[model samples]
Target: MAGTDAAPADSATTGPVDRAAWVALAGCLLGLFMQMLDTTIVNIALPDLTTDLRASTSEQLLVLSVYTLAFACTLLTAATLGGRLGRRRVFVTAILAFTVSSLLCGVSQGPVELIVFRGAQGVSAALMSAQTLALIAALFPKARHGLVFGIYGAVAGLAAMLGPVVGGVLVTSDVLGWGWRTIFFVNFPLGVIACGLAWRRLPQLREQPPPRLDLRGMALSTAGLFFLLYPLAVGREQGWPPRLWVMMGASAVLLVLFVVLERRLLARGGAPLLRMDLFGSRRFTVGLSLSLLFFSVFAAFFFTVSISAQFGLGYSPLRTGLLALPFAVGGVLGSVLSPGVVDRIGSARTLCAGALVLGAGLAWVGLTLQPISGTMSIPAVIAPLVVGGIGTGLFVAPLQTAILSDTSEANIGSASGCVPTVQQIGASIGLAVVSLFFFGQVATQAHSAVPATRAELVADLQNTAVEPLFRAPMADRFADCARNQLTSAHPDRPAPGCDGDPSAQSGMAADLIGKANGQLQEAGRAVAARSFVGAFQTTLWALAAMCAAIAVLTLALGSRPGPNKPE
Candidate 1:
């Protein structure tokens, strides 16, 4: 989910190659591109959907969390299914599912319906994700594996960078007045083309019979993940009620049951989806934890920044996307240049450098936002973003490599499946947790901000020469009314106040009321902006500290996985 975290180190045993192989690679990577593209594209549409659908902040969080939760829950199952059914057969089927789900998403009328469809799309994406590596393993001989993987990584990086821009264009243009719907509809053509190419070009390997799926394990895992994620996603928004706490406890118990069952099953000579032994190695544990921590922070970064740009500052979707472009560019360049850096100084150094750079960039952005109380210009956002992105490219690619480098080849399938799950879980948790902090800050700041804002407006008004002539008492009364109006459910629409009072129907009184309302709106906007600035700065600094922790962790990473290879 966080680019390249779950990439399979499938060192394929291959003998031959042809044009078919290249085409197959193209088709597989296209699927990869589409999958990654949706991840970023969805973020761009969040603010739009929030405004248009009258969605609560909680519901908006659900829109993002459901997809990731579903994807994480299904990765291991989907990976095994692809192996059992044959990767190409499963891959094409997933494309069909993804296409249909995209349709369902585009036409969705409400947040719940849209969230459900997004989960379906996530399930489909999980299926397709497994095949990206599987197809490459099946089609390309060992000789061309690196080349294909390079292409694959490039496509993923490009998609991540391009998603915002594309979403912005579609949303801004409101193609056919589709508004945010165009973002999903755009997936239709890509899914169709990818499906066609996959069906025709990908090889049909005679897959050996796969082991039986652990249905019980799947059930427990699904329920467990759901229980854990649901509470986190909604709890803060709901003020962390007792029911959620009970659910969290159930989630823990269910997951503990899963681990117990998996261990027992492994001892009994039955297959378990995840091998517990994989975590026995210190290096594997440390590296994967570090990777998970890094990814969570990475994912939370975009969500927070997107809200800051679109909701806080009132930037158009297109402009927000453009603001994110430099980050993506740096990400691509970092991915491109990282391999050389790794080859020279080793992965540990590369990871440390990346984490440090990312932390610094985030800190820089936080500093810039602090002065403005979270309000920012395009240049102010982009300059640091470029640095942060390069850090992302540097950190992400190498982190995946280092984490996988710690595990054995036999574990690659499980590791690949687990990697994304961890990344997604980290991302999902980070987003939910950070949103709690962010909104809490916003609410607290806004509470005090409202009165202060009104006072400032009144102070300014008192000093004006014409303030007394404009029915000063009426001005003060309307100002109080306007403050209440500013806090209405629908802030954009004009609301009834003194103007609606029959007793205040005098033309002079109406004019005074209109002036007060206009003044109040301006004051409200300024307060909202500053509150966002404070909240965003707080969240950003917290994330930077997280990054710095990861940087410190790199120093403790044991030598690569080979020294403690699995038995």
Candidate 2:
């Protein structure tokens, strides 16, 4: 918790919640905002990145996963560092690191470069974010803690939901034609100013006599998560080779070892990496699981929808954003309404209702996409997305209340710390699992599109007023070429002059081929669209399964709500 052991300005001169404290709080929120913004910003940009960077499906997934993976890995270590070196000092340094990395990310020339820099940004984000809560705990008086935390909650909620809308606006506007780079570049000024404000306004926090960091514990934990996630992110691309299996096994073993090591440390009278006892609470464990499960689906849903909209349907970035606007709007309403829902029913029932609603909405979206031959309409997309959003809010809005409602005060700091960790890790895991299905379907549907396209090509050729001999060969040739281009979201441009058929009319061969090409391309797009739609359907089912699990787990949480907890 970023060295909570420290005294904040001795609490003598400034008293609690001073002007400087408020400024510090604002700086921390800005820092939090940036991190949250980056998380959502990339979802909309994925399609653009996929095309512009020539990045493979796996690589594109990696770009999204790497940041979260790095963020999760570094969290314990960053928080520990904040404890030892002073939270404010470490937080400021991280801000500088985050800013510089954002600059590098903006100028990146290739996908590989972008991935590496994003990891750097994630690390900085971890260090910077770890301290914000600690600062809040230090600055806010007990009387006002709930209020400040409420504001924090509000910011976190908005940040989580607003990313796609902002990303759509940014990418659509192109902001000086900078394209996706503008998203990262937009961070530079905000980050710099936040850093300055933080350094000037934030107080230094030093643990009395300082604390020793468990480097061994940190390494074991990091290795375990890395091994676990690496294969998930890359395994599909490499066809899940033997080495990947080895990595997965090693990851499990390492995680087991981490658990053993933490237990031994706690038994001995030394600080452990993460407190093992936190898992002892049945409510905490179940709540953590539910949080992870929900967000995992949450993260993948946006990416899946974004790709479906842009690649599958041929919508501009702006149109894609507009369709999704309803989802975001609905989420806001859901967040506002979730408390009453929980109050009217119970946390468990509220959660269950939300999950089921989300599932139904997602099913609607999938069925809606099934009939789509090309380009999904905004009206069709809006209703289901908005319904799904409300369900998402219903599930999301009550998560913390159900989980932390039973948490002890001593564990509150740690509980607060674990929330995002669990959510992000779940997201990382969900995206990896979904990618396996999503990309696999893309390949499957692309291949499946060939025959449908070939038939359409033959019909188009027959109606073209072209000769039968030329038409037959031309359709066959176009089918072969079109099939080859199915892996791409777009169709390959057709070259003039068909092979064979010497008696064909001048330009007639080209014209017939062109007509076939348009359908063929549409067929490819339809396949890509259909594949994405298919994946989303399965993802929704998976999400429903998770919701069911949540309902079951809710049985474990104590029904009583805390005084500070939301209904």
Candidate 3:
């Protein structure tokens, strides 16, 4: 909207103090907070949800992933509808629908019911999210764009980072005895308030002589995105089955066909769900690619850190959540400072600086972790987390500004939809790739620990009454059991042949046997912690490399236009 003509009916000349405009922006940010919060909040509550509903592994995956799938698939269509009907109208409707769906999720008694409700919530979230940028552009004048977008970025980033924190607090506190259901139930009041504010303050800014809906384009794009995102979401957990690859291939074909169809429609002077000319601008194209690369690091870094902190370090959910606080604080600081930086240097240089700072922070984090010590000092990592957070704040909002800098009024909605869709897909793909690397490293490290475990096992059995011949065999079995347990998919469950203590089988004295078993458990935990630490360190290095790559990519971005100058 910064580069586009203002709607004739709208008061484009309004300043930041215009109460209606600021209020409307507040409502949009609230909706955005809800949408981003959902992307990760339910994750921390999964263990409770699984037990409550008796969900299987596949069902658990679906419960977590279906929301993203639905949101990604519907974004393009929702954006188009918002432009044709009305941004405010569609946004308010989405808020009401999202509120209802969240309530339904809270009351769901079965896994299937919850999954279905989550999908509905996702669709509503897409409708709300797709209209946010367009609405912001329409409500605020171009002069205030940087400040407004910085605030928007700060809210969006903070919400995402705080999801686990909030989820952990709710699950631990068990307010109203709601347990995991509190996560969904909490959304009810927020949605109601957002809806009321938006409905009252948001003005209708429909496209004049509204374009006809391109039903075929919508269908193709939806199917294409669904096929592409679904496998990326679940394929790793499912072992990258051949069927998933086939789905990805089909997605490519469908998307290519969709593009072809849209081009032809535009040539014939028909309405297209997406405008092809948006990509013709080098800034939009490069900026979109940068968004994808940056987001890939964004979600993957959190996922790896969450697993490492909770499982590897034996941290409670609340502790894990608290660990991210430094990062959030840093992000807020960065967000607050970014607009001023942009004004001084420009968006491209600011993005480069952010990427470099983030990469350096990540590298510091990786170097600080010592797998040999088998322990992580939380205090040591806090500084790097804060630094990384600041970098995130600096990059995210400005990246959005850079991408849409050249988008025309007619294509703003489409551009908005494309940015988020690419980001979500990038996140999904990053998670899949990082999971493979992380788990594979875990397995390798687990197996490598066997010899040391065998040595410790033999030492423990040395003074026992167990026969010498049986001692070697018992040590071998114990080592194998430890490896198997550490590498198992469900590490919480005992691996086969690992349930009974080896000391009990050796017929030692009761006290000695208990002592030996305790030692064995300690050794097993050490192996796991070390394995996870090593894997986490490797992941951090990879993410840092990605950050460096993002910085390099920023070199290709066009410079931001000066005040009152043409882009």
Model 3 score (lDDT): 0.82
Question: What are the TM-scores, per candidate, against the unseen true structure?
Answer: 0.84, 0.83, 0.93
lDDT of each: 0.71, 0.70, 0.82
Candidate 2, clashing residue pairs?
A: none
TM-score of 2: 0.83
Reference-based TM-score, model 3? 0.93
| Models ranked on TM-score | 3, 1, 2
Please tell me which model should have the higher TM-score, number 2 or number 3. 3
Tens digit of lDDT per residue, candidate 3, span 95-132?
A: 99999999999999999999999999999999998889
Give the winner by lDDT: 3
For model 1, the superposed segments whose C-alpha errors exceed 4 Å read 1-22, 46-61, 109-113, 134-158, 200-207, 370-374, 406-409, 443-452, 459-513, 561-567
Return the candidate ranking by lDDT, descending. 3, 1, 2
After aligning candidate 2 to the native by TM-score, how far in Å is the CA of 267 from where it should be?
Answer: 1.4
In angstroms, the error of model 2 at 54 is: 6.7
Which candidate achieves the best TM-score against the true structure? Answer: 3
Task: Identify the superior model by lDDT, candidate 1 or candidate 2.
Answer: 1
